[model samples]
Target: MADFRTVPFLPTAFHDDATLDLDGQAALAATVAAAGVDGVNVLGLTTGEVTSLRVEEIGDVVAATRRGAAGLPVGVGLGPPGAGTLALARAAAAAGADLLVAPVPAGSDPLAPLGEVAELGLPLWLHHHPAVTGARRSGDELAALATEIGAAVVVVEEAPPGDLLAVLAGGASAGVGGLAALFLPEEVEAGAVGTVAGCAVPERLVEVVARYRAEDAGAAWDAYLELLPWLRLEVGSPGLRVRKEAWRQRGVLSSGRVREGAPLAAASKLAITRRLRQVGADVSAPYPGS
Candidate 1:
């Protein structure tokens, strides 16, 4: 595991749905860095839709974000077969990505992709999504990987509470840096280096990270609890569809319509609106103090 103390896990921002048209992507990236967040992650599960974007489009998004970030470290999310991951990593590197994140395919050697990209010498963030990756690596497995690499392997962003806690315990034991949970603010307080749920609300996400850094655990926890309903409403509901819609309502994205499989339903929209109001989220505005 990479040194968690050294690499702070920042929220991974999503691309705009149809509502924002094409400009939402660059805008979101700037919005994140302008807030003083440590870094911005592109091509995330929430944005870029991994398998959906063409290689060129991926590179375009990375470049646009790099320009918008000005100086913030831009991370590129790489997924799938090692070869594909290597290609994306190289492109991100060319586009000035500060870091790279990839999921180690299950059943296959987790070390394979790591080895492929090891030569790049860029900071690496590994994903620990058991559901997507299929197999889970024990703390011992992760520690051994880090030991073998000699390069920093940052935090593991695992999902679900049970898996996240287990990974955290394992990562702590392995001395691999820190662990990241999906969007569970409570677990973040317990010592989840940072989170990767930037799709729902970028400003709020920055606030959560700031609160965590300031050691305002109580306020951080409260902020997370306040938004828990909205967070839950977003999980696996509809690809980029709902996310784009949420961002649109917040005035961050131009619109909320996503690709084919990501259509939003009326009921889901109502649920999202209810949760946002319940949390006192200013859907009519973007960011804090705006």
Candidate 2:
């Protein structure tokens, strides 16, 4: 399986008018790569805005990310199930995505689609987030699917530490969301391979993982604590508005514009900025509507 330690779920870049910003997405991808993350996953809930983008647009984003990734492995999330999903998978592969990230389909055996996706020739990372997909499977079932489909990794969310450990023990590479930053130390100790997070602070996430790998548990814990507040603020948020705002403040993105119906409140922006500053982030960059 491909190693995916410290993968940051990137946010799609947009102009002040919320139009797709291909160049901006490339720039963000470059920035994340420069920050030393192990890999980058585009078109996921936070980054690619998968639901809103068409297949061609997703291909554009994948190609843009490929350009900015400095040759790092780029993974693209497979959007909703449909005829387009396979086409998008092919497009992503042609655009240089090294792997596929997708949730197991709701209400049916996931093997068929998963097997077909694996046939695309890129390693598949099965996403197991029940809240979003509204589908739940036992560890054995998930492992069976992974084993059957030859999945390279499984991204899980809202699973207890024991459950997460159990998934890993089942002989499948596992990545966790939710309390990833908080549980990272223990998870890493227990052999969890990676984490899919929207912490907006790639450097810190990279540092924590690096510290743990270096056997510096003390420093890793400190870094995790510093990032805890930001993670708390991000989890359960409606969209990537706060994360995009942080990126804008730090000059990683041109604007924090989100699609319609995912607006970022002014109060929320101010609060995010305050929290970022408290953690010593540089937020002096110019932003839209300034």
Off by over 4 Å in 1: 1-22, 159-186, 285-290
Q: What is the C-alpha RMSD of each candidate to the true structure, in Å?
A: 5.1, 2.8
How close is every model to the real structure, measured as TM-score? 0.78, 0.90
Writing each residue's lDDT as its tens digit, candidate 1 over 1-290 gives: 11122222222234443222335666766666666666767776434566666566667777777776767777787865446788888887888888787665677466777777767988776655555657577655665566665434434545434344445553523222222224455445344444454545555655655666677778867776666666666656463566666666767666565544545666767666666667666677432332
TM-score quality measure for candidate 2: 0.90
Off by over 4 Å in 2: 1-4, 170-182, 286-290
User: Candidate 1 has what TM-score?
Assistant: 0.78
* lDDT value for model 2: 0.74
Q: Model 1 clash tally? A: 11
Error of 1 at 138 (Å): 0.9
- Candidate 1, lDDT over the whole model: 0.58
* Candidate 1 residue-wise lDDT at 66: 75
lDDT of 2 by residue, 4-121 (tens): 3777778888888878888888898898898888788887744457878767777788888888898888888886565667878888898888899877777767777777889987
